[model samples]
Target chain A: MSCLGERLTALVDGELGHEERDRALAHLAGCARCRAEADELRQIKGRLRGLSRLPASDGADDLPTDDFLTRLRSLAEPAAPAAPDDASGTRPAHPGTLGGQSTRPMRQPVRGAGPGRPRDNRPAGRAVASAGSGALRRHQRRYLVVGAATLFLGLGAASYAAGGRQEAPAVTPAFDRFAVEHALTSGDTPMTDPLTDPVNQIQTSPGP
Target chain B: MTRYTGTGRARRRALVAGGLAGALAFAGTVTGDAGPARGVRSDPGAVGLLRAAADAARRVPYEGRRFLTTWNRGRSATAEVAVTHRPGEGVRYRASSGAEGYRPDSAADESAGIVAATLGLLARNYSVSRVADARACGRAAHVVEARRPGGGTAGRFWIDSETGLMLYRELIDATGRRVVATGFTEIDLDVPAAGPRITLRPAPPARGADRPDPDMVDAQAAALAPWGERLDGARLARLRSEGWPIPKDLPGRLTLYDARSDGATVHLSYSDGLAAVSVFVQRGSLDEARLPGWQKTVRRGRTVYRREALRRWAISSGNGYVSTVLTDVPQSTAEAVALDLPRGGVPFWTRLARGARRLGSAANPFG
Candidate 1:
């Protein structure tokens, strides 16, 4: 009946056995810092649940950085464990676990007597979380920008091709080329005499 | 005195009996002759005299100053003539006044040429059948009457019996009216060189003031030479080879034929068939505005806008086809014997008219 800080968090989430739950409740009653830590973790979890249910509005002006950080801390926290299976002789994993998709026993946040001690470790952890969120946001923005640019380019190309087809049909090249050839050849031997006799003779005569 | 009177009565009776017998013999001779007895057939000497006179008229070139008196519809018109002929060199001067003068003004030179050609034919074919003693211009002359072999119009000649010179000549029409009559008031043939001083007058100015177009006449003639014959199979084949489409039956009597070059293309035709019209294309434009009895009409083609003159023509241009009734003819029988021509075979008439117009404009030395 060891009542650790981790077991207390598990007991609150209904993951602990009856004996373990009783033991965690007794320890919580004696240690004030652990109780405070448990209370803060519950508040973060409630805020995260509220964020997940928040409706997307037309404007983003009201969303603050503090609210986003609160939601992130809740999602990043470890979840409660489940009970052991006696038939398989193996312990069941916890529910609502973090990154690895594994269901093992839950981990808890550190408890300290002074606020200064927790604050000292909070900056480093916050920096790492902020950096990860920033990377993800930047990747999402790049994907959105690329998609919009591709859509605009596709629309422009389609319009240009349609306009070309709607315009005048292209003429055959052979006809224009032959017309130029005939004009050039006939220029040298323009009919000068109004009389038809000489032109008729030339037309009728066989080539020499 | 009583005896003398009785003798005169007996003498008169004897003279009357003799004269009656002579008259009877002359009547017998006239009745024995055939075809216009005792007229043209009775005199061979007169025929010989006319033939000689006609020959002499054409051979001798002389300058004459005379007067012309014309009677039309019982009205008389007079004109003075001053004509000089220089055998081969052509007529140098001719001047006339009055209505007769105007008739010869535009066609003076052409008429002179026709007169010369007629005289030449007469000179070669003159024959006389009768001769008689007569008086002309108050001078004693030998009158001769001639009959042509084909029974054409007769010719009468009055020659100076003393000098063998012709004094008067008459060319009778088929209707017995004298179509042409020429007489010398004071004829002196083969006279001495110094007899009378003949004064030379200045020639009249040309009728048309415009310059003559010789180049147009030549060019038109060359262009029209191809169309001078009928559009038969051979000619049609030739024209087809030249890329011209000729209709099968172009109905018309060709009245005019002309081909000449005078700095332009000129052609004229008058026909009386389906489209009785005259077509004149000069320098590629229709130029027949002055053809007689023709009315102008518009005609369209692929690339040409033609204005033609339509008219009913009586004369045809071929060698065997009869002309229509639009022209004057002696009889329908004569017209039946006349020739029929194809649509394009009437160039001579046009050529003559064009030449006359061109020559009439200028006093060309060569012409």
Candidate 2:
């Protein structure tokens, strides 16, 4: 990548600042090697999500769900290679710009593609991993989906229950009584307001 | 007492009264009769005419169609009521929709549209003056205008020339816009002088007599019910000790002129003399979901449900008490008064407990 290094990964993760993201995208449009690398990074990121579908099994009580997600996430971080000079040299001098990991090693290319070589034609690693695990991974994914749905439905029911009111009887105000009471002291004739009293059919109009 | 027509002996008597009123206007002898009638033009003649109008409202027998219209936020609510008044028996109002209501003579102070107490307040707050003679409902009327300190007309009243009865009244806001107006569209003198007394007796409904018209039964029941337990200073102080929000004054210079209770609810009446507001307080949380068609608003974290009609209604609830503020004033004034009333706040623990109880009730089928 002549003009971009960790910035390519940051762009794929959508973590770059607006201006820095624009610059990285502009460089990717002209550089074929960086474009291939961006495509490869996207593929690996997709496979990582597929692997994350595995439920944190209670059988391995030591591994919590958050820890499992963190380990799965670690698989996508790639080393930031030394960037060659760009035409304008506007790239940030700090390797850690945009929160990208610069000290890591380059990710191992899956499906036997060599490092630094384009792996566009290789089958996604998700497919290879699923094929190896067979029905076991499928069962774990089904359990994860069912657990998530149950959690969602249970929380919704609990919230509805919390919202239910008690202690006070449902009261619809006696508006007719209220009107007369208001008039008795308001110096108007002690009578109900025809408009406020639902029983009266006085036509109310808008003012200019 | 002899009943006379407009051009008969009554007109001569009215002319003589007018001359006397004009003489009083010039002499200013009745200046402090009600209160300090201080303004640019403090005409006690106008005050006497208004006081006479209040007395005539009860002393004169008349039947007419009166319309009340209130304006708020570029919208208006109007009500046309057919009214019948007797000397001893009070006014009976029949709405256009055929709904009937009764106000017994005892239930009303019969100070016309301006109660005696408020007349004093009006005099204290505005300068009362007899402006001119105007015509209303095809009858000659003496126009009385009350002006604010800044010389703006706060209110205007048109009193019948011959009978001294209030024919029309309108309240004007600080911005010179009419907030409320009520008056007779058409009137007929039943009898010139109040004549002999008449008693109103509810006709007994025979067994299975078609249920006696539910509306009439309701109206009769309302009339028969105890008007209200008038709250005096001692009682009001006791209520205050028990956490009732019985403030002697409210925003907009409205002072509490009357307080009453109907066992379960306390009604506090406030007025700046021209504009009146009533606040009703009851013990219970407001059933917000049941207030269908009401506009809900939250200001400064307080929720208020409001509705505008011939009058404005603003309801709010907190700390196990529900308060409803009703008035013919502007919507903003009603809302401000509703929000200004004291209501206890619910602490975090109380809220949590309430939530837990609700959850328990929901989980229990029998709850």
Highest TM-score model number: 2
How many clashes (backbone atoms < 3 Å, residues ≥3 apart in a chain or on different chains) does model 1 have? 38
TM-scores, one per candidate: 0.27, 0.55
Clashes by residue pair, model 2? none
Where does model 2 exceed 4 Å of error? A1-172, A189-208, B1-41, B110-114, B190-226, B344-367
Worst 10 residues of 1 chain B by lDDT: B302-311
Say what the RMSD of model 2 is: 21.7
What Cα-based lDDT does every candidate model obtain?
Answer: 0.35, 0.66
Each prediction's DockQ against the real complex: 0.00, 0.08
> Top lDDT: which candidate number?
2
* Clashes per candidate, residues 3 or more apart or on different chains: 38, 0
Question: Positional deviation of A198 in candidate 1, in angstroms?
Answer: 41
Candidate 1, position B167, lDDT: 69
- Candidate 2, residue B90: CA error in Å? 2.3
Q: DockQ score of candidate 1? A: 0.00
Runs of candidate 1 with Cα error greater than 4 angstroms are: A1-208, B1-48, B58-64, B67-79, B84-93, B97-127, B148-153, B185-288, B291-367
Model 1 lDDT, full chain set: 0.35
Tens-digit per-residue lDDT, A56-154, candidate 2: 533233223332332343343223233333311333222221123322112222224322222221322342343245434654686799999998667
Retained native contacts per candidate, as fractions? 0.00, 0.20
